[model samples]
Structure formats: structure tokens, C-alpha cells
Target: MDGNRVATLVGFAATLVVLAGLVWVVGIDDTLAALTTADPVALAAVAGIALCWLVSWGLALWTVLRALGSPVSPHIAILVFVAAVFSNNVTPFGQAGGEPLSALLISTAADTEYETGLAAIASVDTVHFLPSVGYAIVGFTFVAAGAVQLTRNLAFAAAAVAVLALGIPVAAVLGWQHRYRIEAAVIRGFTPVVTTVARVVPRWSPPSAASIEARIERFFAAIDRIATDRRTVIQTFGLSAFGWACLAASLWTSLYAVGAPVPAEVVLLVVPVGSIASVVPLPGGSGAIETVLVTLLVSTAPVSAPVATSAVLIHRVGSYLLPTLVGGGVATALGVDHAASPET
Candidate 1:
């Protein structure tokens, strides 16, 4: 079986485990009652909007690929994006765990080099960050103006968003300024492995130190290709923001479905913070994401504990679980094999 296909199985099983855990933690009877009593149309809309979120982000990826000279169709871009989501969902630490595999799939599906694919996803992530903070800032502004209120958990969530909005940009700028030093450190770290491989496999010609350097250069070159294009950057950003909107809307709809309507700003605030909590080193950030979302909703919004839990569960079914299943199907249909040689 393909590595990704196997990951799909793992992802499916993990989602079940997470779902079961959620039911147990939140009380199965309450969860069942919430689901049974919820508005079917709004719950359906949650899943549909989640699909829209995927498509929007796929468009963003397509834009980046076209800028990087891939020129794949939007359909293929969505396939790659979904497969990438599967990779992320099945692994620990979310995107960080899945990126290398996702990069491989992107290169394979898009007919681009590995470094270019790597750069595409990395660039997408960098671009995606700002929009998240932008949404959070808008919500935080409402909080400041007395339009919205916060509990202890939500206050902390807002404070964290404030730091992320300020911190990420500064970190990015500093990292870019010192990129050469960082590159040198990376090269130095890899030198011993290259030497050992060369020593172990004398019959085969291993990649030279220059080849590694060139690969790094190409990675940056791909990022530069996208960055240098103002139009492409704008399109990517626009698509990303649209995707974020779809996600927030999905959550808001979920809350509404459960008859726990909250202010729109509450969704704006909670969605981004929930996303941030997704890096908690759990597969697809399963446990942590739900916890953060439920806490934030119950704290900052006019929702009961059980209703808040149900709403988050419903929202995640679309955002996390649905994507995992769909992406897995995509990986299987596409026959993506990350272990295969690029030339094959």
C-alpha cells in the first residue's frame, strides 16, 4: 500500500478515537441529544462550507504553483491540497509533521521539483498567517470596544492572538535578514550525514555538498519567484482570506444549528485561536483544538457548556474529519506514493 493510503487508514482510525473520546468526555447522551435536536440544514451547511474552505485554499495553492511555474489545473491543485490535508491530519504537530510528505505529493502531482513544491507550501503557510491574525485583530477590536465580552479563557485567547499578530511578523523579518547564517547552520548540520552516506555507499555517487547548497538555493528561488510577483501575492492572499472566511462562517453556522447563536465577532475570535491551538503535537491537533474552541466559546459567547461542546464537534467534523476522509480518498485515487523516486 502507498504510504499516504496507509496514513489515511491511520487518520480514519484516529478520528474515530478522537470522536469517541469527545463523546465520552462531553457525555454521550448530551451529544446525541444535541445532534438529534440540531437544525439539519445548518449542520449540512457546516460541511458544505468546509468543502468551500478546501476549494478556496486549493485555489490559493494553485496560484502559488502557477507563480512557481507548475501550471497545473485547479482540479489537480485541489487534489494535491486535499492529500496534503490528509498528511497533516494523520500526523502529529499538524502541518509541521505532514509538510515533507505534502511537499512530495505536490511535486508529484504538479510536475514540479521537490524544492519548488516545498517552497510552495512554505510560502502558502507564510501568507496564510497574516489573514488569521487579521481576523483575530478584527474580533479583538470588538472586544476592546465593548461590543463583545470575554471570560478568563477568552481573555487569554485574545492576548495570545495579540502576541501572534505582533510576534510572527517580527520573527519572519528577522529570520529573512539572517537567512544566510541559518542556511550555513543547516548545511553544517547536514555535512556529517552526507559524509557518512558517502563512506557507507562507495559504489553509488551521492549528491555533493554543492548539490545540497543548490537545492537550498532553488527553494529560496521558488519563494522569491512568488514574492517578486505582486499580482500573484495579492491573489494568493485574497484566496487565503476567503478560505479563512469560509472556516469562520462554518463555525458560526454550527453554533446557529445548535440554537446557540453568538455574535459574529465571537466566531472571528475563536476560529483563529482554535487554529493556533492546532499545533499542539496531536494528530490534526484533535484533542487540543476541540478543547480550545469549546473553552473559548463557553467563555466569550452566550453558549452553554454542552451546546458549546456540540457546536465545536460539529464544526470539526467538517474542518478536521471530513477533510481527512476526503483527502485519503484523493490520495488513494491519485495513487500518491511519497516514497517513490521523483524520476519514476
Candidate 2:
């Protein structure tokens, strides 16, 4: 494998070693005992999280599809949603890979124009971020209230801000706002380089600048078209909030299961703050998530290190691992049957 790929694998392995070391230092027997006797209520909480996750994402998908004038049944929405999830979690750099696959699946199944599907998918992501950003803002208050260690909390908070600030939707919006200038800049900046490269490389040619500019215009136009409907925006944002709340409940219950329950406000604050690490490129945020979660739990709760570690492991099983395996199966069963027509 290439150096970067090798480095990623090494990093992933090192994280696993750290987790195992943590468990060992805390005593394997104690950790096992904690897990074996997990609270029943917490087990039941998984069901609630599953429902909320499916419904929230499904509704978001359905809302965008309807707004794009291509409505599908709930079943189809779930299929597409799971497919997107699988693509995201299983792929390298999932967030980058997931959106395009989701948009492609929507276009193929719902028979919407590709640009429309792209816009809808982008909108759903942007809408979800609206609540996420709000939580981050409110999350800082809890941090200030001594919910977590100041340095670690600030680190995670800054990471979240950086992730959102550098996200594609924000970049797209910025580009859209300066469409003409950006388009001109792109051509002016790249044309001469392309021309010189083409001179040296006889078989190579640059893409048509006019085509590139036109596509940019089309992309923004699709976004603007979706923006005309304020109702859909409200609906998607509401669903996102409910979805996020369910996720927080899942984390709380995980803590409760380990007999290390924190305050509700603590759960609300820590979960989102920890989730900031999910932006890391590792599959399912692997090492990154566990580190953030363990830090948050220890800092925010009245639990021992072992208890916090156990709870974080359990939470990840439900939130990341389970969904990834199940979503992969769902995606496999559905396949990519472009010929299968979507229901009206």
C-alpha cells in the first residue's frame, strides 16, 4: 500500500491498542462485569435510538425528494438512506464519498434530474448542520460551566467550529454569493496553466471552461430553486432536532447502563462536543471517537475511568458499529437497480 494508506492503518491499529491498554489497566474482569450487568433500561434505549435515527433521516430524505417534485414511499426512503449510510461509513473519507452516492441513488430511483437530487441532498446536510451548529453554541455554555476540562473542551469546540466552517455547503454558499467573480477567477487562474500543460503533454487537453462555468451556475440555480419553499426547510430542521435529541438519549442511556449516569444537560453537551471528532477521516471515526468520548465522559461524569471507558464502548457499538453492519447488509440486498422504478 501507499505511504498514506499505511499510515492510516498504523494510526488505526495504535488507537485499538490504546483502547485495549485502557481496558487492561482498568482490569478486564471489572470491565466485563460492568458490561455483563448493564442496565435493562439502557438496552431498551437502543430501540428508541434506532427508530429515531431511521425516522429522522428518512423524513429528511422524503422532505427533500418531495420538494424536488419526486416523492417516494417510506420504504424507498429507508433503502436510499441506509445505502447512503453504508457508503459513508464503509468508504475512506466517508463524508466526502457519501453525499454524491446519495444524490446519485436519489436521482436514479426517483428519476429526478441529477442537479435537483444533488441540491436536495446538499440541503438535507445543510439543514442538519443548522441544529448541529446550535448545539455546538449551546454546548460551549456547558463547557464554561465546567462540564468538561477547559483545555479538552476548548480543543473539541474549536475542532467543531473548524469542521463546519470548512464544510462544502458553506463553501458552496460562498461561491454562489460570488458566482461571477469565482467563475472568472477559476478561468483566469487555471486557463494558462492548462494551456501550458497541454503544450507539453500532447495527448492531454483541458476541460471546457465554459462547461465548468455552466455547471457551477446550474448547481447554484438548483439550490435557489429549493430555497423557494420555506415549509420544507422548517420540516427538515424539526426532524434534525428530534433526531439529534434521540442520539443524546442513546448516549445518556449508555452511561446509565454502566451505572455512571450524568445529568441530562451533561449528556446534551458532551455528546455533541465529542461528535466533533467524527469528522476525522478514519472509518467510523474509529480511534478519534473513542478518545473524545472517553475524555468527555470522564470530565463530565462522576464515573471512574473504567466505567467511562465501558460506557463509551457500548455507545459506539450502538451508534456506529451496529448501523454500519446493518446498513451494509441493506445496501447489498437493495443493490443498484436503476431500472427499478420509484413509487409516486
Q: Which candidate is the best by TM-score?
A: 1
In model 2, the worst 10-residue window by lDDT is 333-342
Off by over 4 Å in 2: 1-29, 146-173, 179-214, 339-344
Instruction: Assess each prediction's global lDDT (C-alpha) against the native.
Output: 0.84, 0.71
Query: Per-residue lDDT tens digits of candidate 1, residues 228-319?
Result: 99998999999999999999999999989988888888888889988876686668778778888887887776677778889888998999
Model 1 RMSD in angstroms? 3.1
Q: What is the TM-score of each candidate against the true structure?
A: 0.89, 0.78
Q: After superposition, how far is residue 334 of candidate 1 from its true place, in Å?
A: 3.3
lDDT of 2 at 64: 76
**Residue-wise lDDT of candidate 2 within 1-344, one digit each (tens)?**
38755865665576577668778876788778888878877777865686677678778888878877789887787667766676666544545646776677667767777766677787787777777666655655665576434666566665665565466457867877787897789877877888788889988977677866776677677777677789988888999887778877787888888787887766666666676665666654566777777776666567777777778778777777777777777665555455464556
Candidate 1: Cα lDDT at 274: 85
Candidate 1, which segments miss by more than 4 Å at Cα?
1-26, 147-150, 197-205, 336-344
